[model samples]
Target: MRTAILVDGGFYRRRAQSRLGEKTAEERADELNKYCRRHLYHHGKQVANLYRIFYYDCLPMDKKVYHPLLQRQIDFSQSDLRTWMYAFIEQLKKKRKFAIRLGKLADEQAQFLLREDITRKLCRSALQVTDLKEQDFLLDVSQKGVDMKIGLDIASLAYKQQVDQIVLISGDSDFVPAAKLARREGIDFILDPLYNPIKPDLFEHIDGLRTCDPHFNPNWSEKESTE
Candidate 1:
């Protein structure tokens, strides 16, 4: 059967870090591709055309941030310069702590302020705050779009019937509707979830589901790194 591999780049990257140890984007893609090929062949479902690997990621302009690492690769610098403005905003959050004086407020308000002080102390001791560079902060802010892009592409590919089977390598529940549609269309939906298992509702929508263990394999590298 013809098979298509639709990748959620951000999802894969984050999950891969936990399973395969920390790795760059290119290394993560290499590991994922290797496992995918071996799994497909093991199931004896190959032998036909393997459709193009569709990677769904937002454009820099759409994200409103130009990641230097990505921009350097494309040789497109000087894009989205205001992305670093997040640093200024973060500083503002740290500096704007409300203060309360016992004599200036009523009894109930003073008690409320005391509780707030305890909570603030707990927060300060528990959570570790750190600054982010322009690229890192932009990635943190623009991560929501990654899931939307993945869901949209899943529905698009199934509606088009570009391939017989779709290998979705994600644990996102957002694709539940698309998975259900693929099932209705008689398309084999194989979910290659990361170490984190897909939710029960999402699995119920798919035809088949699988997971990649910590063990590494070969026979899946189409070219060099796929980033």
Candidate 2:
């Protein structure tokens, strides 16, 4: 049976950092393939056909701003962290089975005003006005259109009959609808929470709740270590 592996890039990175520890771009790129293949065991046999691996992520935020934590002016383009992340993405793109999907990161305050809670606290003297800082007013950057792209790809995979099964590496419940549709289309939907237990409702939509994390289940990994 042909299977496809899909990943939420942000989710994968955060969990991988915690679970697998930090890895260079080359190491991460190699593990990405290994983790995708670990799920092929169905009824005790691996599926030889891996259709492809789809990874969705946003470009690093590029901005010239004052760093609140560092207390200095900084250009995002010149940041070491940003440079490393881009290199990681580039390494991922080099893999033939992997497809990188790009989205955008939006600065919330660019379109929205300061949060009401902060305003209220300051008015009530709960927060000293003198203590107000630029970081306090700065808004968080959020990924935009990543979920929609994932859903669209799920639909395309199902409707086109590109793969009979899909292994998704994500914790977000945003995939519920897409999973339902794929399951209805007779595609086996498997979810890998990467060491985290997903919401109860999420388990109902997927045909399998399997994870490759050795920490989650020691015995399973012990018996099956090659993957």
Candidate 3:
């Protein structure tokens, strides 16, 4: 049976950046893909077609310290949009014999705008950081819509029986409901967390779960050389 692995981009990036703070985006992506492929094969599942990799995230603002192109990628949230739109269209098709309904603004699109608003508000807050005082308000670089996207994809895949197994690489409890549904539908769901304790809610729904050991893998310092 073929396996389809879904990755939460925001979750992956945060864990990876915390570990490999000095590594370039290219390095991080490469390592992440490598790790994912290795783990998938470890479970004796062949990755047929590498089905839909819906990267759920939002865009970073221009003023943000993060890379601009990377920010653009976040803003575009292309992969997330692709899957979301595809689901919407599929629903429309099933509802009517010849449905041609246009899709509306997505949850991610709204989140992107809201996050930008929050960033501006944080900058204006009176509790500004002094030279000696650390800033209390942390700005979020639009990483919303990920949970929703992940939830939608899991449910859709389970309903359609797209793959024999679904491997999720996220630690968020928000996915518990969708995972539960997948399990009820007899889909094998596996959760792979990035160096975080798996929540009990996840266990209530998924077929199996495991954490990546930073000690064995040493998520950090993959290489001393910089890009």
Candidate 4:
């Protein structure tokens, strides 16, 4: 059967970075293709034919960040770390059967709040800091329009009968409506939520559930759920 795979770029990147560690972008590109194809394998037996891979993400914003601890303004977009990301995306573009869809990063500023546990510890005198001269926080960046694009594409493929099955690599519940539409169109819908907990309500909409493997990131916190 012809299968089209769709991946949430942000989700994939965060999971891979946390789990796989730092591999050169060139190396990661190779692994991305391999990782997608592995899903076609069932318990060591490979089945189905690939149609294409759709990767959805927005570019990092060219925005400045306020570092409370450093007490300075930093241009995050120009960081060497961002250059590494740009190089990685370039490598992904060269892969055959891979389509990268770009979205926009929200321009509004976001603030990072300390984790509740950390805040509690500080209140209980269990947490201490050597430096009292500066505040501590981080800037959070978010994406916009990515979900709409994903849903539109899913609808397009199903309505056009481009593939027999659609495999989505996202944990977000926002795709439930799209999944329902695909099923109504007679397309098999599969989901790979990366072993992250998925709500049963969301789980019931898909035809199958699978992942390339478990998350290798050993740093998951206690509050993270498997649902």
Q: lDDT winner among the candidates?
A: 4
What CA root-mean-square deviation does each model show from the true structure?
16.5, 5.4, 10.5, 4.8
Off by over 4 Å in 1: 24-26, 43-49, 58-140, 215-227
Q: Cα deviation in Å at residue 7, candidate 2?
A: 0.6
Q: Estimate each model's TM-score.
A: 0.55, 0.78, 0.59, 0.86
Measured with C-alpha atoms, the lDDT of residue 209 in candidate 1 is 69
Residue pairs in steric clash, candidate 3?
58-74, 59-74, 59-75
Q: Residue 79, candidate 3: how far off, in angstroms?
A: 22
lDDT of 1 at 42: 54
Write down the lDDT that model 3 would get: 0.57
Worst 10 residues of 4 by lDDT: 130-139
All models: lDDT?
0.53, 0.81, 0.57, 0.82
For residue 139, what is the lDDT in candidate 1? 29
Which model, 1 or 3, shows the larger lDDT?
Answer: 3
lDDT tens string, model 4, 20-119? 7778889888878899999788888879889999999877766776666565767867887678779888998999999998888775765455556666
Residue runs of model 2 more than 4 Å from their true location after superposition: 42-45, 66-73, 108-139, 215-227
Q: List where candidate 3 sits over 4 angstroms from the true fold.
A: 43-52, 63-137, 141-144, 212-227
TM-score of 3: 0.59
Give me the runs in candidate 4 sitting further than 4 Å from their true place.
Answer: 123-125, 128-136, 215-227
lDDT of 1 by residue, 1-227 (tens): 88777766556655666546765434444565565565456556555456655554332222233344344222113343223222322322233221111111121211111234344655777422233222332223334355656666667777888778887877677778877888787788888776565566665788886665533223334364463
Error of 4 at 26 (Å): 1.0
